[model samples]
Target: MAVVQADGRLWMTFGPYWTGIRMVELDPGTGKAVEDAPVHHLATRPDEPYAVEGPEIVEHGRHSYRFASYDACCAGVNSTYKIKAGRSASVTGPYVDGDGTPMPEGGGDLLLAGHGEYVGTGGRSVFKDRGSDWLAYHYYDAEDEGTPKIGLNRLK
Candidate 1:
């Protein structure tokens, strides 16, 4: 999700499942879509079964960071999901991960992945709260029969 300019147009992902994510700008006054606005084609993994989703754009310092979750999810012990990140100089981007890999080309810098009892950690969202940044996501716990768990992290 992203807020474009001071007009408060909230842009979020709307999708038809594992295909791709589209960004639609919403009308702030009514929290409805501004009907005539163009639907932006944001990003997609070219790979079949394209598991990319959850796009969150954050404007920090001189860059806009684009966060996305990749790989399979929701199958308990079978999940292979993980969170990835990329940044661009502009809101609309040819976003590249740390090594300069473009997101659309299946490139993303690792943000979070399974560790210990946690497996398939993904579906992350980043935002600012009271002048500080935060990241939150879900994971499947392997230590407790694969139950889903939520994790939160405060970013500096």
Candidate 2:
């Protein structure tokens, strides 16, 4: 979940702790942490278990996006993870979802969720290619006896 970034927007994928997700500017040539670059703390869940992870930042036109996964995952048929998203005008942000609630305040727009045999759809990556955005992630397929399946969806 390491995102290769320029424009001083380095998105680091983080995990079970959720708070571990950080945004820092890096030196592209050396792939090392840049000096004087402040690390911005991203996501957290105080009420439930800290299940958020897999952070990605994508710049689309005039807006910047923050993507994450929420809830439990990797439990096959029992996985409860789902994909969530937020957007900001700035790279290092106080991101707000579609409803305008702040991300650090447990706010995110639900992008993907479990349905029928598709259980726990999470672990996501986003990329912009050829003027189109693509969302890729993994989900548990109960129809196939809870096997892991890759899902690719075109996004706006």
Candidate 3:
């Protein structure tokens, strides 16, 4: 996932391997990551790093929130993916959940999960629309033969 910071720098986070996620700042003009920048590990789940993926960061007020997909994906109705969240005061950080659990230690508050006809609610992105923050993601619809569909929610 990518975000343009308030300082006008482009930053991104991604998992090169399903179990490993990293964040980096980029040189906007060159479209390349800053070589000397410190690497930030977004996935450090001791039990199952594979459970995490599709991370996105959003800045709100004085904090930056990190949202990510956890568990299995790409299985249609069988998928177990869900969304989790943590927040930090700095852009490159040690994000923590509401309970003060460090995210790098496999901690995050459940933000969204599959329920009813919605299966695998993951791959989320938060953005602003009409002065309100919105979450956009995709999920498999159990009532529709497990077809993938886009989902959106206005964050409060």
Candidate 4:
């Protein structure tokens, strides 16, 4: 689980079925999490069934919070895998996409994915730099065929 601290509050993301990622807000005043707070569903589909996993939350600018996760569409048989992101002005949001669509039922641009050369890419670790951000993950080395190797790159 990855956590993001903002405005003296802690935010956590988790998935019960590995299909939908949800966020919970913690109240520092009571030292307990607010259960009734709305949980934001990470991904939703209208056609093919998909799962959202490996959720990471980060505080971007001063007031914006970004949420990231790996989306796996079509579980079996060469499933399409990619990293996606969404952001909100508050820690616990109604996160919106690049086009201002709500993430619970909204879709965003593909941050990273396989490009024919790489088989598939998912599982992401997002971290902050001096003032930038980076993403680290494992990908199947094309040269090695089926060998999985770690890959790291600046997210900018």
Candidate 5:
């Protein structure tokens, strides 16, 4: 689990080591602890199973929260790697897609996958800057082709 410090609140993204992505809110006034808060589901796909790892959250201003997750469709194989994203207005949300579909039922946008220049990119962490967002993860280098290395890149 990782917590992000936003304007006046604390937002956290968490997931089962082998399952789903969820978001929670912490009370900043109470020293950054959840105040009877419930975790909100952010992403899940039926066709893929095994795990959802490395959840990171970023506030896109004051009202939007974006959650990024690495989907391990099949554990132990680079071929099954993929990354997905979801967004919500509140810390706790019924996060919907561009078409208004909920996550657990296959919502959100596809961010990246093993098929790209970087193979097996997973274990992601996201951050916000002056006006941009970045994604940090470990990827299997295409040059070495089989060795994994850590990388950080701006996410447009």
Candidate 6:
């Protein structure tokens, strides 16, 4: 995922699920990672051996929040995917949850999860509209024969 920070720097997070995910600075003009940019771990699934996916970064107030999908995905109602998050003061961070546990060491605040007719609530993206922040994502609708459906929530 990519985010344009308040200071106009472009940042991105990416990596293989089985290995790990990390953040890197990008040159806005060149659309490429800055040479020799330091890579910082975005997160690894809490209590699991693999890293999370679908990373999203958003800046709010004095902190930058990173969101990622954990568990599994694309299995319709059987999917175990859920969204988790962490925040940091620096864009390239040692992000931590509300309890102050570091993200790279398997710590994140539970943000969204499967509930009721919705299963696998993940693949989230955050955007601003009309001066307000909004979150958009997809979920498997169990009541609708496990069809994937879009969901949105206003970030407060």
Winner by lDDT? 6
- C-alpha lDDT (0 to 100) for residue 5 of candidate 3: 69
Better TM-score candidate (4, 6): 6
lDDT (Cα) of model 2 = 0.78
Model 4 score (lDDT): 0.65
Per-residue lDDT tens digits for candidate 4, residues 74-143, read 3322546677777777766666778987666746567888765554576778777787787887666666
Per-residue CA lDDT of model 1 for 1-156, tens digit only, reads 445542244665555447765666777677777789777666677887788877778878888777877788899978888888888886667678888888767788888888888898988878788999999899988999999999899976
Candidate rank order under TM-score: 6, 3, 2, 1, 4, 5
lDDT tens string, model 6, 32-93? 88999988887875566474887777889899888888888899999988888899998787
Please give each candidate's TM-score. 0.80, 0.88, 0.91, 0.78, 0.75, 0.92
- What tens digits encode model 3's per-residue C-alpha lDDT throughout 5-100? 645677888774356567888877887888898778866566854568777889999988888888888899999899999888987778889898
Clashes of 2: 0
**Worst 10-residue stretch by lDDT in candidate 4?**
68-77
Which portions of model 4 miss their true places by more than 4 Å? 17-19, 27-32, 35-42, 63-65, 70-79
The residue pairs in collision within model 3 are none
Clashes in each model (backbone N, CA, C under 3 Å)?
0, 0, 0, 0, 0, 0
Candidate 3 residue 122 Cα shift, in angstroms, is 0.6
Kindly report which residue stretches of model 2 are placed more than 4 angstroms away from their true locations once superposed: 4-20
CA error at residue 135 for candidate 6, angstroms: 1.2
lDDT of 2 by residue, 76-141 (tens): 999999988888887777778888987778888999999998899988888777888899899999
